[model samples]
Target: MWTTGKVIERIDWNEKLFSLRIKTDVEPFIAGQFIKLSQMRDDKRVARAYSLVNPPGCDYVEVLAVAVEDGQLSPDLKALNPGDSIEVTPKAAGFMTLDEVPKGALQGKHLWFFATGTAVGPFISMLATDEPWQRFEKVVLVYGVRLGEDLAYLDTIKQFIEQHPQQFVFIPIVTREDYPEGLSCRIPDGISSGLIEQKAGLGINAEHSQVMICGNPGMITDAQTALVEKGLVKNLRRAPGQITVEKYW
Candidate 1:
């Protein structure tokens, strides 16, 4: 299940975060799924899993990555240039997919999407498809990062707003930087303090909507607990609940 792809495009957002678009005849994958990519480091082959940034139906596959200080994989991954070839796993897999979201949840209510940092990848993937906008009457996507500059996918949000026009809302939260346009607190605070619900004008409830959370383990854990206090249960295969979550590290 290995394929070779060329780096068709590359973007350096900042010193820490970067973006890559790979050109390959990759198989179609569900939004919210991830691909395994391998690169050579210290003469040893190392593989890591990265959530695909492109939505379904796209010809090219995109990925967002954060560089580590002298990370074994980062040096090679970051050095990718146009026409550079890399190894990619043929199959993509993950459970944070929207397909797992119960049909009953999106029939006519709002769907809450929460993520921090690069965890936003899966949500972007989900939004690229027609299922969310077609089914849910309204959608709320909340993305959290440390600084305003760290926020990615402004173009994606712009495209969504232009296409849907108020059908969906994106809230960017920065804990350290306070831009008047973005919230300056953690996402859980936004939920508990009633800011997220108030801004969206829809209070989250088990009967009316469902929640999906993705981010670092700390954020996911804290958000899950907070949402539970608000009457949302963590969704499971056997015992379905109101919230579905994926941890980014």
Candidate 2:
């Protein structure tokens, strides 16, 4: 299941967030799926799952990761350089995709994407594909970050919003920013104050909306609980689905 790839580029978006583009021979995977990357030393292999940020059909795979100060994989990952080869697992896994949504539920309905840190990876993947363009009437992305500098993909997301003026809404929230523009207090605050509803114009009602959430455990849990309190349910493969969630941590 593991393959090798050379690091093609390392993008420093901020002091805490970085992205790596790896050149690999593996085939593309769905937008919301993740790949496990490994490195071998001595007799042991260390690996971690990272959501692919590149859209399907790209020649290279890109992964965005936030570096926790003393985290195991991140500090080393952030130090990678071009031409350095890293082990990558071929198989991609996760259920947080459009395919998991009920057959007709997403069609002509508003799709709300909630994310924090690297969780924006999959949503960016979904936005690049024709899936969101053709299936949903509207797409609202609420990305929460600790500081304004942590909003790494805002430029890309803004460009997408500009290009698809009628299709998508991009909202970036900074929890620790003092005077952030185009930023709100937090995801939960946005939801409770009806700011998210006002921006999406779909309200928080379950009938016309389907939400996909990804992020740290606490953020994901809190967001999911808030959505459920507003009447959303977890999507399951067996019964066929509502909200899809993937926890980065």
Candidate 3:
């Protein structure tokens, strides 16, 4: 289930975030799915799940990760270089895939994606694909970070926004370091407080909307509770609902 791939590129997304582009011949994966990557440590296989940042079927699998200072995997991941061998699990994982969430237009609903930190990985893949734009009347992506420096994929998201203009919305939320552009607040606060909807001009209604959340445990829990209070429920394979979650951290 695990295969070795060379790190084709190592990106310094920011001081806090770094990424790896692994060239592999694995099966195609869904946009919001994740893969386990590992390296040998103390004679044991140490792995961590990382959401794929690129669209499915790309020649390279891209993973966006926030370097956890003094953490188990961060040291090794950050130390990777081009041509460095990394153990990549071939089987893609995670329920964050779009197939598990609610559809739009046909179902008369909107789709919202909330992400923070490196959690932006999966959302970027989803937004790049044609399925979302075709299925949703409107799609809003709320990306939250601690400071303006943490803002990422601006060009990529901007290009997608330009192409879809009317149907896709991109909002960045920064909780620290006063930024004149992006709204400043926690993602759940932005939603429960209505500031995010106000900026997008499209209300997030539990009745006619489905939300996908990916981030740290705290953010995911808070956002889920807020959405549930608004009449949304977590989608299950046996019992479908209006919300889906995948903890990226």
Candidate 4:
């Protein structure tokens, strides 16, 4: 289940965020899946899982990666150029896809996707799929970053919202920058102060909402606790679902 892909393009979406387009020979995959890339250095094998950002039916595979200071894979990946070959594992794995969601719960419900940093990966995948767009009456994405520059994929999300204005909502929250348009605070602060509800026009209650949380472990824990306090339960495969979470650290 391994293949080699050539780097076709590198786009600096922001100062710290970049998108890589790799030409692969494999068929398409579910939007929420990920690929494992291998880089050999010093005769040691190092690999990392990166969620795909390209739409489900695209001809090339696109992945958005953040440069972690002194990170093993990020530094090398950041330097990749077109015509370079990288090892790509074919079988993508993760439980964050729509198939893992409870069948009837997601249909005709409001979906609130909250993410921080690179954890926005899976949500990007889901948003590109027909299942989410066709099922949910409202799709609200709340992405929290350190600053305005860290808000990668803002334009992409805006494009999605622009394409389907009746169905999608994108709310960007910046903790470090004083941006005039986005929520000017942390995600938890927004939740506690009813800023989230006020902006999205939806309460935190589980009756009309389903939430997917992806971020650092601390942020996920705090967000889950805050949501639970508001009476939302964690969704599981064996049980009816309400919230799905993916931890970054």
* Best-first order by lDDT: 3, 1, 4, 2
For candidate 3, the per-residue lDDT at 90 reads 85
State each model's CA lDDT, in order.
0.85, 0.81, 0.85, 0.81
**Candidate 2 — which pairs collide?**
none
lDDT of 2: 0.81
- For candidate 2, what is the TM-score? 0.93
Q: Pairs clashing in candidate 3?
A: none
Compose the digit string of candidate 2's lDDT tens values, residues 162-213: 8899989887777776634556566866776777787666687677777888
**Can you write out model 3's per-residue Cα lDDT over 1-249, one digit (the tens) per residue?**
899888999988787688889998668788888899997889998889888989986988998887788778877899899989898888797778889875543244688899998899999999989888887789999999988878778889999989998888888899987878779989888878888889989877656788889889999999998888777888887877888888765
lDDT of 1: 0.85
* TM-score, every prediction: 0.95, 0.93, 0.95, 0.94
List candidate 3 stretches off by more than 4 Å.
Answer: 103-106
C-alpha RMSD by candidate, in order: 1.4, 1.8, 1.6, 1.6
Residue pairs in clash, model 1: none
Candidate 4's C-alpha runs over 4 A off are 105-108
Clashing pairs in 4: none
Candidate 1: segments with Cα more than 4 A from true spot: 105-108
